[model samples]
Target chain A: MHLTFYTIWPCALFNINRMQSISSSSYAVHFNQRAYDALNGHLSEKSYSKIFIVVDENTHEHCLAPFMGRIQGTYDFEIIELESGEENKNIDTCTQVWNVLSELDGDRKSLMINLGGGVITDLGGFVASTFKRGIDFINVPTTLLSMVDASVGGKTGVDLGPLKNQIGVINQPEMVLIVTDFLKTLEERQLQSGFAEMLKHGLIQNAGYWEELKEVSHFKLMDDLIYESVQIKNKVVLEDPTEQDLRKILNYGHTLGHAIESYFLENVEKKALLHGEAIAVGMVLEGYLSKDLVGLPEAQLADIKNTFLGRYPKVDFTEDDIKAILALLKFDKKNSHGNINFVLLKSIGDPVIDIQVPDELYKKAFAYYAEN
Target chain B: MHLTFYTIWPCALFNINRMQSISSSSYAVHFNQRAYDALNGHLSEKSYSKIFIVVDENTHEHCLAPFMGRIQGTYDFEIIELESGEENKNIDTCTQVWNVLSELDGDRKSLMINLGGGVITDLGGFVASTFKRGIDFINVPTTLLSMVDASVGGKTGVDLGPLKNQIGVINQPEMVLIVTDFLKTLEERQLQSGFAEMLKHGLIQNAGYWEELKEVSHFKLMDDLIYESVQIKNKVVLEDPTEQDLRKILNYGHTLGHAIESYFLENVEKKALLHGEAIAVGMVLEGYLSKDLVGLPEAQLADIKNTFLGRYPKVDFTEDDIKAILALLKFDKKNSHGNINFVLLKSIGDPVIDIQVPDELYKKAFAYYAEN
Candidate 1:
């Protein structure tokens, strides 16, 4: 199946024709220009008994209308709207979606289209996977973060209380459509939050990609950059679907980054940080640890700190905050037998997995971030 | 790895040596005598970070002590007990289990042993499969129903409200250990509930087995009978893991049986029926439908009715009850595009799928069942 999507540049100055589409053996990841046409073509190739589109509030208002207008075929479909936030990604939302599917007489042959950011794709993919022991689902990620990170991987789940992704399963979708145009609807903070993941894809695997990302001064959603990030993540996931060995490298900054994200999210007195913001701090701190423990060059560590700190404002973590974050680290998913394993960078694009960082190193790493 | 277990029959007079163990490519289904020893040997071969045994209150009191005493290795293990019933098989219970695992530092390397009936295996399998995006789990089914039915099939899930298995995923455990000795602790009715599934295996695929089952009078726990049932189910499941075509035959009477089970369970005034008991009624009714729709021999249909009716008590359904049960049939997992599909038998050993039974035929089948 093939589809051609027209790109309307915001400036209206240059109508440059660019095709952004990447295909792995199992599925294809389509960018904004071809997303609608690709979806339309895919739908036409197969017959679905019922069509259910799941979207959060943000996408329902901003992305749905334009997406529906571009479709070529007339088919019966229903729209299921969810509250737009990370807080709503839980069992309750899954129950609601499951109930809606049941009430609407959705069956094994039904097709579910997840049409939003990470929360929608994660929760919707999970719901689809578990409903009647799984159903066919497609991902139309509407944020830069989801396009670059969530959409590529089959990681689908909801958080258990303060812990993020504590209950989930890895099940791939039939296809993933990455629409970079949706970034136009996001706030600067949200857009930047997504950029952090793109930056991470480069940091963990490709030095040239990391250098190109460093040159991205202004926050612009480029199809090529998003495509490159998807390729990096997809490659890692394909090589290690179960996170046995090679996949651990993808969790480079996620160890402490996730703890920090959960800490800020759960602490009422502290300002909650977007996933990217929390992980940006994580990358900086882990970079310091890498320099000390993994023989990473001090110059490269300083460069990492400068690049992240320039984009993400530093948080003033009190001693109590540090203790709480450290405690939360014990619950990190990467840990096995209570040993906190960190994926530290050996260089800008190289990562070493299962490295145990001492508490003293953790304290010193925090101190370095504070001093910087 | 192999281990031999000596069966100490509850009645010393029946000390017959019975070898009841079956192996598939990935796992084994061991009968009472060999179950514990097999489990011990399997555990010894693997090194786990921690061991968590999940059981219901019934199993904790009646089975846990015996199960623990049989183990030879010294390993740190925790007991997680939940209320025993179908009512507790929901997402809330899953959350409690996940919380316990997280609190106890259960990691990807940790192993979970499910030691109860279908409820324990279904919910525990789901928890292990989704925890940290999946973990290793073993099923030690301690009830006849679980041994003959739930133990062999990889289907794991919880009901969504009144719907049966509306939310779940299909994930196989590392191994499944079935001990028929647990049947000694069950009430007569509970043991009979399991017999219905054994009867189903015969009716769907083996006429000779059906004839042998009809000859049995007492509610005795026979390891050979259990083994045969497990072999039948395992063979069916292995052929069609995803229930694409051949597997639907496994749902023989489950189409209406599940709806009836859900209706009775949800209604406060109505008495809930055990899964096998409800399905026994379903098989009788569907037997009549089969004779009418698929040209099954009238003599065989009569034989099926006589065997089941003689064994299982009839459930009186009011017209309103029938309507509610019919409404619930629309939510059957085997359904596609809102069509209610039934797996009906053309003969004692022959099964057909996707047969659309007319509403009038359904009424007549119920009438035939009532008259019998």
Candidate 2:
């Protein structure tokens, strides 16, 4: 899974080479120079009527120039730049993109290239999937979070109000292009935000991967680690594309994580947390529950708590916050008929799905996180 | 294809019998009492968190009471009604319904019952399909247009501004239930509006069916024609679900028909035409093109024109209206790279797809429809 050498594509303007190719569901994630080559080849092969490059302000400024510099193609490209930030990740943004595509003569044969973080890929993929019923699209994920997780899964959507990804469809992109170089532009906080998911990947599926992550103290953005995270997610996604049975393992942290994310996002008084930040808190709390309910070893529970707490700053959940977050649990996507279901751990790397935690335990889970 | 006898459903509260079932791709089109039986079984079998009955104003008043009176099985239901008409089939309306469903705690396991015409079925289907990624939904089409055409095909969408079906997805419902009794409540205009699609069915695929439709002087709502029409459409849909090649033939009159429909719907001075009314004008015009360009026999072309005009009142297309209508043609769903493609007839029951009509013939097609 390592990029040992570089080979230039014949028609490429820049010295691009293959990174790594990982298969997921119906599509593949092409990394580094391979991604650029894939895009270039895609541009040449598909007689796309039009190609739309979707970018938010951040990517439009930081990542787009480098992207354009590296990619080579002879097709008319439309730049559809959206406003940045999580707040803009809603249906209104989707409507704007849809209107832009329609106004610019984007027919069914047109192709959309989503070139930003999760918000852009999610919203752009959704817009492409629904525009005139649907149109072909590709993803060029530029952030650490998107590269590792969102890029692999065909989970495209927009937030419904403060609810994350409430309205969307699971339509695969042609291929996901991951250019890790773009991650250099991310702030340290953003990098940390994304690394949380990598940690999550280890906790749920592979003890060796968790130990490997534990060995590294600096939270380095290693491409191998990123690739491993993607492979883990892609495996789960492939097994259950529609999030049935086995795929429920992917929601190990997401059940409570999403509610915490939504709670912080909506409350005017609190600061909004990045997805990984909230999910980290969720993993810590859920790990505590896992030990008590699902037979996750006490030592492993302590290890999970310490590992997340070491890298990610622990959120101080007030009594009020805990109550609201619990109420929000019913809105978790995993729930069926309002029963809040959790994916807990039997032990390190061994996950159990559909474990119900009593309401009384939710308070204890929070208290465990709050303690030193 | 006629209902010869009635057989009672075992769990049915009343003497509801199997009508006719025509299978589409993954689902079936159940007609009459069979529709009720299908709904009964679906409700009893699946543990849906909630049931949502989507209706427009017309169906809410005239259709809902009877629907409620007939449907069996104990399940809590929510009634979500929208304003009636094509104008209400947009994202704003989708947002409203989504908000209502979200507010009422509609989860992933919820079942959406679209109990109206194309507006309800199309809009409701799109909503259900995209809600929480996707959800189970059933369509109980109350209009003839819906029963014959929209029901069999999994084409779900809403118009974008004046553009017909500009924003939508191609998603199949759990099943499509057609109760012909609902058509009795429709105005003559509405029923006539639906019959145009049936005429399309006869003209595009079955010459014998075309002759049969021609034999009748009045546009009578017949269940046999509805079933046959649905079966014809179902066959095409099954052959090409995504409208790649064979399905493009479904767009026979729709290229110009949709533009004409959009033009009339958007214009301030002109009264908005029903979908079928505008499509009827399109059929007459496109049929003339077919005779000249695609070698549709002159007698059959004349027959097609007379058949449509006899039932549907002729829409007077002014030169200005024709020009505007032609401009609107580029936005047709069938177009690729701004190329206005038409599905012209080689003969009655034989449609040639993706045929580009010359610009000069525009006025002539309009004149052919206007003259006696």
Question: TM-score of each candidate?
Answer: 0.94, 0.95
In the predicted model 1, the residue pairs found to clash are: none
What is the Å distance of residue A362 in model 1 from its true position?
Answer: 1.6
Error of 2 at A331 (Å): 1.7
Q: Is the docking of candidate 1 incorrect, acceptable, medium or high quality?
A: medium
Per-residue lDDT of model 2, residues A24-111, tens digit only: 7777898887887777787778898887889988998898777776756456777888888888999888887777777788899999
Error in Å for residue B212 of model 1 = 0.4
In order, the Cα lDDT scores of the candidates are 0.85, 0.84
Q: What is each candidate's fraction of native interface contacts (fnat)? A: 0.89, 0.80
What ranges in model 1 sit over 4 Å off?
Answer: A1-20, B1-20
lDDT of candidate 1 over A1-372, digit per residue (tens)? 111223322212213337567775478887665666677788888888877889877898899776666666666677898897878888888888898888888888899999999999999999999998899999998888888889876899998888888889988898898766678898988888989998888889988898899899776748778778888988898888878888888887788899999999998888889999999999999999999999999998998899899998898898999999999998888789889998888998999898998889888888999994
> Can you list each candidate's DockQ?
0.77, 0.74
**TM-score of model number 2:** 0.95
